[model samples]
Target: MHNDDLSRFFSENMAVDGELSFQQWEGKVLDFAQRVSRGNCKGLALVSSGGTSVPLEMNAVRFVTNFSTGSRGAGLVEDLVVREWACILLHSESAQLPFRRVMDNMDTERFFTELMAPEKSSAVASIVGTYSKYKTRLLLVPYRTVVDYLYLLRLITVAVCHRAECLRTMPMVLLAAAAVSDYFIPRTLLSEHKISSNDGMTVHFSCVPKVLNVLSDIWHTADCDVSRLFVTFKLETHDEMLETKALKNLTLYNCDLVVANKLQEYKERVVMYWRDTPGSPTVLQRPPNGSIESLIVDCILRRIECDATGGGRS
Candidate 1:
């Protein structure tokens, strides 16, 4: 994407409805990144989760969204926190959250009743204690719309770039697991009010810019020695196109790794294409007792460690 296009996109979309002002959100991210830089953490991971919505009208009564529960991203953050890594989680407001999904399967009434019961008090304590342990290391930033997601993501990278000196010695990874919308109706094109349901409606959608391109070409090249690794995900329905698309994304985006999953088998298997290990795609299977995210995080950290030790790409 051209710089002009990006500038125009942000200029038009950044002012959309949000709970926090852009300046306030930027400050939050900066403060969190600074804390991570000063702490004795294993590394820093900027993880994006969930699906974004594209509003059909300026009033936004109706929108288009995808089926991303953010389970993988939430699981990755949980695993990263367990390994002592500082994480900045940029997620959809409605996405599944780390540590909170443990009891997500239970009915709300039953969950509360069980928690208040003497027998399940220990479970409550365990959950609370785990969140407390990592509260200082994990930062949660929530967004709803595609515009919000892109804006927050850019804000985060810029903040980290600003703290480059303090974070120079640490490994940084950008994990883009969010299932973002591929098309959106820009503010200029959206109707001022919600469309009436009396008749069928036809809406035109503009293509959302390829954010990975911007991330790789701009954010990753910030003037610093921060060892930044960019990883993106590809979800495909066709099994035959999985590896090919994953490799294509790895090269096209200048990413360090691409994690590809099939819609049907994503919970059970993934194919990873590593930049350093060309032509050898690794297939990862979920362990019987653990999540696939745990394995993915292990692979990421190992690659980061290898690079740090001069065993991988410089």
Candidate 2:
């Protein structure tokens, strides 16, 4: 899409309530990016996770949302921090968080009690210590609706690119792991208040614009002279069409890598199609007691390291 068309798309589809506070959010992102750029780190990773919601009304009592607990994205952040990569995590408001996932299996009552206990458990203390150790390395940005997600994403990406240009030598990676909504009701079309249930309702939705189409252009034109990689994910229900769709997106979106997985086996394995060798993609498998995200992050970091050394894409 051309720049004019992209502008029109955003103007038409991204209108939201005034409560979004995008300026404040943008300031936070800029501050985070600047801090990371000045610090000594391997590279910068902008990791987006969770699902965006489509509000049915301006007041937003009803909405549509994608299915995502953000576990994969959270796990990716944890592994990236371990590798000494500064990360900006953009996730849904209610999604799972990095470091906090260590308590996922604990009962809700026990989890709250442990936090309030005079003596913290080993698990809670460890998690807290890890969080403190890497507090400056990770920036958490949360969004609620699809409008907010897209707006915040663009803002954060621009900030990162700008800061990267200042450093001129840092590598950058855009890891889009969020389960974003494909359809939404524009703000102009949404009901002003909560819809009544007195009668049957019929609603219409408009397709969400493809941001991936323009992301590469943004990175290139933001005065950023650094090694950059763009990675996107594809989740399909039909196993037969998974690779085909992933490859198609890999080419269509100009992505450096497309991680494809079937809905039924997403937690177990994912096939990675690289821009350099789409035909000979790599398949990543989860370990018996480890997360698939850990393997994925390792592969991405290796690619980044290879590119930094003047080696071709991995």
Candidate 3:
């Protein structure tokens, strides 16, 4: 019989044998497979643009940037793929991760020369070629500015929530990982050439809508349990008082878990407190230096399984 069929059959007959049997072994194997599969999913996803926004004029105008190079976010994406999660990577302008690979013959000279070619656009051609080869079952939403990112996020939020409400079977998990810009410049400044420094510039600044706040509020109204959604927080600071601040923020935000990271240290991490309701903060013993991605994925998956099975400890 096929391996999957055998596993299924064994699962069905697990209760028949009072003593443990190969069926139990099969169950363990399946559990491990599922964990790995969850890490490598090519499923539906909506990733936000990664970068920091810097304020230009004290409180008025600002720069909508596609900065920070997106390395950590890209690494998180790769880790998700390992879990079998399908993702729709929403890439911002000037993102560091190159979604497409270069051609064998590509070089600076070729790239510049191709720009002047009268034939089909090289950019379009490259896209077509890459999509044709990599079975990238993903819907890519490209954005050049912070406004575009916000709009796309809102659109996806509505769609994903609608699906969750309509389809009562599978649960939807949202990971709020993007470093969204907190401010934007006025539309009038988009075309402005130069402003004289003699006259002080004043730009009225407004807060960018928090995507997580929206999600959390709406989902709470829907009466979804906090355990159903996992939110992660990244805090960069000194170890002296980082944990206290991180835990306080977690309590305020009501996230399932907050990974308080200190930039100065290597693999060793000081995880800040946890929920008073279900359990306490888990202290991870000295993890390997280059295993943050794996640790995060494992923690999330474990929590998912725990919640799915009625909050039972595994």
Report lDDT (Cα) of residue 141, candidate 1.
Answer: 89
Ordering by TM-score: 1, 2, 3
Candidate 2 lDDT over 26-89, as tens digits, reads 6776776678778888888889999999999988899899869898799889988878888899
In model 1, the Cα lDDT at residue 181 comes to 93
Task: Give residue 148's lDDT in candidate 2 (0 to 100).
Answer: 80
Per-model TM-score versus the true fold = 0.93, 0.93, 0.59
What tens digits encode model 1's per-residue C-alpha lDDT throughout 1-93? 865687688887655445257558777777777787788898889999999999888878998996599998999999999899999999999
For residues 1-314, what per-residue lDDT tens digits would candidate 3 score against the true structure?
A: 23244334334322334224322333432333344334434333344436655334323244646365554455455555545554445566555443342332368777667667777476658655644543343444455455455444544555444433332233445555566776665443333444456887666655554455555554344434434454554646677467666676566666656666675542455363445432466655446556565566566667666777787643
List clashing residue pairs in candidate 1: none
Winner by lDDT between candidate 3 and candidate 1: 1
Q: At residue 64, give the lDDT of candidate 2.
A: 91
lDDT of 2 at 109: 96
Who wins the TM-score comparison? Answer: 1
Comparing 2 with 3 on lDDT, the higher-scoring candidate is: 2
Q: Count the backbone clashes (under 3 Å) in each candidate.
A: 0, 0, 20
Could you tell me which 10 consecutive residues in candidate 2 have the lowest summed lDDT? 14-23
